[model samples]
Target: MHQGDPRDGAVTGLQAGDAVDLGRGTALLGCGGGGQVDHMVHALRVALGADTVPVVPLDGPAHSVIAVGLVGSTTVLEEKTPSGRELPDALAAVERWTGRRADAVVAAQIGGVTGPAAALTAHAAGLPLVDADLVGRATPRIDQLSLFVDPLPTVTAAAVTSSGLRIVVDAPDPRDLETVWREAVSHSGGWAAFAIGPVDAELLAGRAVDGSVTRAVRTGRAAGRARDVEHLAAVSGGRLVARGRVLDVQRGGDAVSFVHGSMAIRDAGTGAVVRVEAGSEWVHCLVDGEPVASTPSCIVVVDARSLRPVSTDRARVGDELAVVVLPGAPWWWAEPHRTDRVAPRAFGIDADPVPEPGQRPARGGVR
Candidate 1:
């Protein structure tokens, strides 16, 4: 493990092997969004080389923690690679805009690429990474973050393209910020590196999902030992709700903001069928046309053979998969408005978000 400053003392850094675990953990948490981490893992490995990337506790003495990740359609990102400098450039831009140096960097969400992207940015900037995140998983919009619901001050944001172009926005309204950032991403050839927030440790302590980074690492390690859904469930709050081979996939309307679609997975033995809806992230899932799991609760599809997650873009016909459902972060359950913001209805599904089996009822009864 790479060590940070002696004054910082004993901080655990992510070794090269941890990248694989982090990637798997993030894919599980992505809820079928957050883009794939295959490229990110390669990037991080090359960037960190023989040294471990330092990770600090969120509660550590950092006065300012900036959230950093890629913004825009994951489909576009696959074709347009980042310049390897976009994140650091955006981080520098955020620092200039905020007039405050980033004391640490935190993942915007614990999804496939974003977590590693944040870690890479922190390493590039020579700052410690916080073992926490704004959202426990990926969401389609900027307004979905717990920090947004907390209405944290808009400390300015920077979006940098792979071409080295940069645009900074200072919108106070989260919704407006999303709109502007999306437009900027569209203009930048559909994706860009985004740096937002200077959320203080004090504010993050109260609002950010604590220990999420560590959870991702743990979940990744568990995945390596997973023999079945039961093993996966033991580590993540995930359960195998359905198993089948994909029969068909129908994409929803094309949007610059997200990749939307629906897919049907049919059981080979029983011929039972389940349909999964996606909006950047998987939003709702149904077994035999009856709601089984919906947004606010994570619905994921994993390869039955390898137990590796299958992103919506990659779910093909004849691929055997286990549909798994996991409980959302505590903040989503605690905040009614937050749940409503990402509810099935928000994704054009008519049903309400459903809780995982044996899980406590969502507060306010699932909007």
Candidate 2:
């Protein structure tokens, strides 16, 4: 197997403890969305048991790479447990559809569950998990992948349901594929494992977000030791914008398949209010009606006492919380086309995303 260049600071392979880090980091990266990692973490821990999952550098060998993940409501994932075979079966279906073997695996979204799930699948398949992913953070739509941002050719996609039903799609338009696959997920009892792509290392390196796996681990480790909001901010590159107790929560009426809602948090000290909007993921955050952070970038809420991340559904009245805004992947903010896809307006908010303090200027200046 090929390894990363030490000079380039690439992670050579995953370590046993990295799973804990990945779980924590991915939860933070999920930006208050992507199913929580608790179940997935337990699953991976048992499956990997003192074994490290191999990681391939972005510049490693030129073999086919596949992106794998689960799609549906986090609420549903809580009730249905994976049999541990869904992803590998999806990979097999992809290979049969493509008529080639995948040399390594990558994650479609690096979030609470998807990151560990991808690693476990790669380990089970006897392939390395690339230290990169399609989405640096989680997003609501399947079409949100970085591969689509570059508009890479998606040769084929395969999905497997818990009941063992499998479906494969070959489409010219990625958006069409997303629509079709989402319906399949809805029919497959709300969640399914999916595999997409046959791209080689060079293409994967160019299109995928690099170093995200390592970054997640670092963030997780920092979060574990963080003592307060300031310490958490310093470690995660986030800004502690508000400290408050929940005032009210209003869920949107969209029949879309993801979490969609808004919560009002009142500053415990000043009584000033900040409202956070959600759409499968945290999309927009407002402080007294002014935009502070928006999607693509991460807006997270942590329990004031525990300093643990709070998912939208789990938030409630009188719950003390601290809202933090972390910068999105630089790629999302680097271009006009990319920013537009995940902008606050894209989620129906009437404002632009507030860029992080030192973010690279977008083509149109923070659209």
Each candidate's lDDT (Cα)? 0.79, 0.80
Candidate 2 error regions (>4 Å): 1-10, 255-257, 365-367
lDDT of 2 at 277: 91
Summing lDDT over every window of 10 consecutive residues in candidate 1, give the lowest-scoring window: 2-11
Q: Give lDDT tens digits, candidate 1, residues 211-309.
A: 777778777777888888657766675776777788998786744325578889886666879899887777788888888888777788899888888
Candidate 2 lDDT by residue in tens digits, 167-248? 8998877777778877877787788888997777777777788877777777887898899977898888788888888999
In TM-score terms, candidate 2 sits at: 0.94
Off by over 4 Å in 1: 1-11, 254-257, 268-271, 361-367
Best by lDDT: 2
Residue 150 of model 1 has an lDDT of: 60
**Backbone clash tally for model 1?**
0
lDDT of 1: 0.79
Q: List TM-score per model, in order.
A: 0.91, 0.94
Residue 262 displacement (Å), model 1: 1.6
